[model samples]
Target: MSGAAALSRPRWSRLLLAGLLVLGLTACASTKGPGSPGQKLDPWESWNRKVFNFNESVDEAVLKPVATAYSEVVPSPVRQGVDNFFGNVGDAWSAVNLFLQGRFKIGVQQTMRFAVNSTLGFAGVLDIASEAGLERHSEDLGKTFGRWGTGTGAYVVWPFFGPSSVRDSFALPFDRLASPALVLEGGNSKAAIIALQTINARANFLRAGEMLDGIALDKYTFIRDAYLTKRRSFEDDDEEDDYEVLTPETPANPQADR
Candidate 1:
């Protein structure tokens, strides 16, 4: 085969993959079935189940073991510091999204949290902002879009990323772009940072995963319900009540339908 033809093959494959994702999203949005806690949000359950199984296999074979080893080898303080560092980075992005969502006061609070943590918390190795009564309001572009009246189209699961809605899936690229870790110079450095972040996150969830495994008859359903519930809570307008009212123009409360 010609070199150009060979190169075109990979491009075609990527296009095919993108087409499949778009098709899946369309199906998920249009298909309606009987409503259950899990089924209510997951119209694409069969595909999601297959993806979930794939994720489970990957996790059991790779992530679970690595995370287990990391948790055992690393000290709790060090792990907490790693988490805090990433969270501090996230706060900067969150503040931007909060402002975009027309939440100025909370946005300012998040900005303060990031500044305090980055400096006073020793480059975010400690969470000094929480101690100072500055709450962490984690926001992302997906949540910002939801606040702007974009609907949560459908629940879907990606290969390694796991559970996400159509809206969140679209926002994933922007989220990645917003990540401070990706700003590192070398590819190796970026990969290492991402891997550490992933491992640390998984390690933090180890106990919760074990508890879920022990109690839930259908683990997939339990996780799906829990994820949907949590995402829905983030989109809920009632959460605005938790924040102090800033201004009439920039209302603390966002719209409920997301």
Candidate 2:
């Protein structure tokens, strides 16, 4: 294959994966019928279970060990700073999505939070905004779609990405585009930043994961229900109802931890 063709192949493969995800989720939603209660929301339970197992295998073989090492090697303060930096980046995108959802006041608040953190907090290495009472409003394109009345269709477990509904799966690409790391000039640099972020996030959730493993008999079902519940809370207009989950992509909410 030509050099250009080689480069384009991966891009095409990603697009194909995305296409299959959407189609599969849509089909699952359409195939719904009278059955077990779980089938109502997760019509593709069989397929989702397979993907969930794959994700767990990958996490056990790779992500978990790496995250464990990162947590042990990195000091607490430095890890917190890394979290703050990425959280600040997310705040910018949150503001945009809040505006798109016609939440002008919260959008402005999120914008201020990003501004304060970026400048006063030193490129978001410190969360001065939160200390200053500028609350973090964690909005994303998926939540925006929910706000726009898009139904959360058929829960699905994506390979590597974990739990999501049809609407969220569709919104994933757009949300990913908003990541600051992706805007960097080189693919390798972007990948490195993204990898760092993912590892940092997983490290943060190590305790929670352990707790989950102990308590949940069916880990897949437990995670799926928890994810769907959290996503539903986001769709509710009552901002006070907001909560956080231990997902790799979302920044940890300190208040929720408390």
Indicate the residue-level lDDT of 152 in model 1. Answer: 54
TM-score, candidate number 1: 0.80
Screening candidate 1 with a backbone cut-off below 3 angstroms (N, C-alpha, C), the clashing residue pairs are: none
Writing each residue's lDDT as its tens digit, candidate 1 over 1-258 gives: 999999999898556445544543454446565565346557788999999999999999999999999999999999999999998999999999989889888888889999999999998899999999998888898777666555455678999999887767878888877655677998988889999989998999999999989999998888888776666546222254222111112233544322
Model 2, position 43: C-alpha lDDT score: 74
Minimal lDDT window, size 10, model 2: 242-251
Summarize candidate 2's per-residue lDDT along 87-174 as a digit string, tens digits. 9999999999989889888888889999999999999999999999998889898787666555566788999899888778878988
lDDT of 2: 0.79
What lDDT does each candidate get?
0.77, 0.79
TM-score of each: 0.80, 0.79
Model 2 residue pairs with clashes: none
